[model samples]
Target: MQPSEGSRIVVGVDGSPSSHAALRWADRYARGVGGAVEAVSVWDTPSSRGWSGPAIDPDFDLGQARELFERELHEVFPDGLPDGLTRHLVEGDPSEVLIRASEGAEMLVVGRRGRGGFARAVLGSVSQRCAQHAACPVVVIRQQDDPAR
Candidate 1:
């Protein structure tokens, strides 16, 4: 009476409105299909802020990324994650990160546009890249009514 590992739906979350919408949609879809949803957020130290000294610098807090990811999860699910839902915090490019996370997943869900605005006019870079490279089907959720359409 439980979904197999292959039925897992991997969603890319970046704390953006669109990404939040994708998470909600994934939750609904997973419920309908009796599957599980795993929320994934990717973060990396900017090149501009790369290591300037030893990896263990008291001045630097490595937990920042995990904190951010948890904060986003809370924002999306203030009531807490659905029963059996999972979460992950990774470090890497969004596209590469989501693509890798989708391995063996039944589906990959993403928002139409993330934090990047005009830069992702057609399709958000991460969504586009995942659609092109993901091993499973990709579902792009619209965050808002596109008045232009």
Candidate 2:
């Protein structure tokens, strides 16, 4: 079936190795599916308040975040990324942003874990939430092994 304009694949990146892999995978899938890829990164302003603080900064630096998202695209695709590829920086909880974006996406791709220090045996909160609530299929790419495997 032909993918709708809103059916572009969405990948979440946090400048981490696993997220890089997700970008690469999403790019390849987009090409094969004759669709575009969305390179998305949700940046929140660091809050001074305790755990109940808002997820994103009211004055989030969108420009810098966009640059980082584009840089990540280049790193994953190297020579170039597919045409129609776009990047976005939304301010909010990562899970909420991704889930909302996924409403129009053919699929959502994310790393098994994010910047949080945790074992691969579990998915990051964002990834877990996306997998549970996304409108489309979700792919969680695990980090590469340390070569001892």
Candidate 3:
């Protein structure tokens, strides 16, 4: 679909380096198309179900986490951002939210793998799902390789 003035470029952010790259790429594309940018972060608190694992604290403090997410977005958005820029912190699955938001967007962007180690070539669940099901075109941003690493 052709990008219009009200068209949106949706991006999924997890506050990771790869996610940040996706946000930057989305920002540039949105600017070039004279469209809006939506930076969405999905936060789903784990439930204390009948599962055996590490002891989970039901009352984990998420205030700091939200603050960090906002701060990181600001940092990624250098040279200032457009007024159309929006940050959404929804409580749901990342892939679901991304697909729903992309219904009306011109395009969607996400990281190949977010905050996870996939020694070889493997796409993260969220990115993979988005790519397979999103209504709009999707771009998978790869994390930059550090020469020092």
Top model number, lDDT? 1
Candidate 1 deviant stretches above 4 angstroms: 1-6, 48-62, 117-124, 145-149
Error of 3 at 86 (Å): 0.4
Rank ordering of all candidates by TM-score, starting from the highest: 3, 1, 2
Prediction 3 global C-alpha lDDT? 0.78
For model 2, the superposed segments whose C-alpha errors exceed 4 Å read: 1-6, 48-60, 117-124, 145-149
Ranking by lDDT: 1, 2, 3
Model 1: per-residue Cα lDDT over 39-94, one tens digit each: 99876654434653345532243377678778887777798778768988877678
lDDT of 2: 0.79
Name the lDDT value of residue 107 in candidate 2: 95
Query: Which whole-number lDDT from 0 to 100 does residue 87 have in model 1?
Result: 87
Report residue 50 deviation for candidate 2 (angstroms). 5.2
- Whose lDDT is higher: candidate 1's or candidate 3's? 1
Angstrom error at residue 16, model 2: 0.8
lDDT of every predicted structure (CA atoms):
0.80, 0.79, 0.78
